[model samples]
Target: MTDDAPRNSGTELQTDWFDTIRINTPAVERRAASLPSRRSLKKEWQAAWLLNAVRCMDLTTLSGDDTEDRVARLCAKARQPIAPDLLDAMGVSGLTTGAVCVYPTMVAAAKRALRGTDIPVASVATGFPAGLMPLNLRLAEIEYARDQGADEIDIVITRAHVLQADWPALYDELRAMRQACGPARMKAILATGDLKSLENVARASHVAMQAGADWIKTSTGKEGVNATLTVSLVMCRAIRDHHDRTGIAVGFKPAGGLKTAKDAIAWQVLMREELGRDWLRPARFRIGASSLLGDLERQISHHVTGRYAAAHRLTMA
Candidate 1:
């Protein structure tokens, strides 16, 4: 799906949509655990899935020490994620990451570096990693990132609202952030690890979708636990439910701690099993990780050459 595709135009604050929802923790955990063990792709099939994961990746750099030079290099990686020789070996061409995610201050640098490409620059706004800032300032930060040429704005939601069960407040804040985003797509990061329960994750996901979040992300990558399969399953079910009711597909992004080629394939399997092939595209699904690309490169190289290369052989993400 492209940016031109119709977006989720959100509904009013309807507490009935999720007020009575209750999560079965053990069942969710059992299903999430069974996913990886049930399916395994091999050889060419594995390579193809990894390549798709590459196309759906949010190649990211969100560090306090991030600089323009680093953002430029990251954008360069996004443009040509796989080495030419490897891509040729796999019979793949025009392969690039879904987007290059960076801090709000680095959006311009990313845009300049990714010039002349279809890749979108996604910026984490609204006090990312921790959305504890005042609401006005957080909304201003969204506008700032949008003005800086961010094609997508990843806004972190205040976990307190979910903890306190203030569904109306959460919906109102997200709606304001969505308006502030203007033309840029808004991704509401629920930071599930801090929400304290699977039920909270499900309810938060519903609220975010109802408030016009183009995507519901699992984490900000700074939490103690980020993007667990169990948590992701709950979120995906909520997405499925939202689509069932509204006939609109909201995207899902699982960020933080997703490393290795196996991790890449596992999440894709989860998406395929839960949301079908349409959600496998970049428009509906994104895996947020920095080192994941490097590992994917290594695995692809091994697939083509039948030998593993040194980790240093691949370009740094």
Candidate 2:
């Protein structure tokens, strides 16, 4: 199914048009700070939430030392993210991550390793992280990754455009990248940590959606400051606003720095509370992390056996 296909194809770019999204910093921070204590789940409920978190994770490995063998192992882990016995005992069937994310060069390895499975191979394309390369080179990277069987393209936006308030340039760049992606879903990484302000985050979210991004992701996971609940709230609210106007649901991915079962549940609650229960699914929300699965597996083991397993016992691959 192409449920993740670009939601706003053929939509004209409206650079000057966006809802007035004023963000109250103190209020947003307070709300984010209150989240940990306000929401808590235990035992069966906590395990169930963690399983849902796993199902919605974009299992990722974007390190410099990532090799085909490493990607193969990552893909294998994606195929069976949790221990089979534990999964069976927990009564969770057919569990898998939302996708397997890797560098563009690793797409083929991941694709081959994950064959016959529904898990999409997501590639970080378009001069990822920095996005300082020329437009042609960036666009070509998207095409190359697509040619190599990337089901989803995670393209980093030119942060300079946001910094300079060059909305039109940003819009044009993303539109071309979307066209290059062909049928593969395109996720515009705003790198919210770099955007600086909540207003910038909201605006970038709008511009990316206007340019036909299937998803508006928060970070490249390389920034000193990665995904935060405050940024996520801003971006998700932007998504909610866009959906209300366009009747198109764009997926949200909060990548970087998200670890532990508690972190996953916190994000789940944010999605559920901000965008409703529908956004809690893999189709609408994804958490990107490399080590998050290990922590989640350990938590699940604790839930099932009533004893916490050492972190070393879990295999993140």
Candidate 3:
């Protein structure tokens, strides 16, 4: 989806929307486990799915040592994610990763590097990995990134609000962040790992969407746990529920710990099975990872050449 699409205007803080919701842990686990086993793709079909995953990926680099050079190289990779020969072998042309994600300070470098392309530069703001900073500082951070030319701002939400079941507080904070985002789309990172329960995940998802989050993300990729199929399932259901009530579509992003080709396919399967084909696009779905492209290249190469390429043979992400 483009930035021009109608955004979720959000609704009043309706506690009854998710107040009595209770998740069945065993059932959710069973369903998540069954997905990979049930759907099996092969040969050309598998190749196509993997390519779609590439189109939906948020190719990222968010290290403490990240630099302009690193972000530039990452932008280059985003522009041509797959090798020309490999993509040509598959009869594909003009393929690129969904976006290039970087830290706030790296936004300008990324924007400059990706100057001619439609690819967006996403920045992690609002005390990423830990939304423990004061609210004013977080809002200012969002504005700073926006001013630096970030197309999307991924903001971390305060886990305390969800942990304490303070729905109003969460809603208010996210609303302010949304306003701060201005033209830059706001993605609310729930950090589901810290929320503790599936019920909390569901509730927080509702509040975030109700607070005008364009997308609800799974994690910061710095928690003890990040995106898991189970947690993602809860978030997807909440997204579906929000759509059901408001006639608005909110995006879903699964970040952290997604490192393999299999991980890419499984999450796509989840999105397809749960939210339909619309959610499979980059505008709606994004897989946030730093090393996933390497394995994806390996697998796609294996499909194209009938032999897997060594790790070093592929361009690094």
* Maximum-lDDT candidate: 3
- As for lDDT, the candidate ahead, 2 or 3, is 3
Per-residue C-alpha lDDT of model 1 across residues 34-97, encoded as one tens digit per residue: 9987777999999999999999999999989999998988888998998999999878899999
Q: Which regions of candidate 2 are displaced past 4 Å?
A: 1-6, 15-19
Cα lDDT over the full model 3:
0.93
Cα lDDT tens digits for candidate 3, 1-317: 27446888888899999999998999999999988866889999999999999988999998999999999999999999999999999999989998989999999999999998899999999988798999999999999999999999999999999999999999999999999999898899999999999999999999999999999999999999999999999999999999999889899999998999899999999999999998988889999986999889889999999998987889998
Model 3, stretches more than 4 Å misplaced? 1-4
lDDT of 2 at 162: 92
Query: What lDDT score goes with residue 101 in model 2?
Result: 94
lDDT, residue 54, model 1: 96
Residue 102 of candidate 1: its Cα lDDT?
93
Q: TM-scores for all candidates? A: 0.98, 0.96, 0.98
Off by over 4 Å in 1: 1-4
Which stretch of 10 consecutive residues in model 1 shows the poorest summed lDDT?
A: 1-10
lDDT sort, best first: 3, 1, 2
Instruction: State which candidate, 2 or 3, has the greater TM-score.
Output: 3
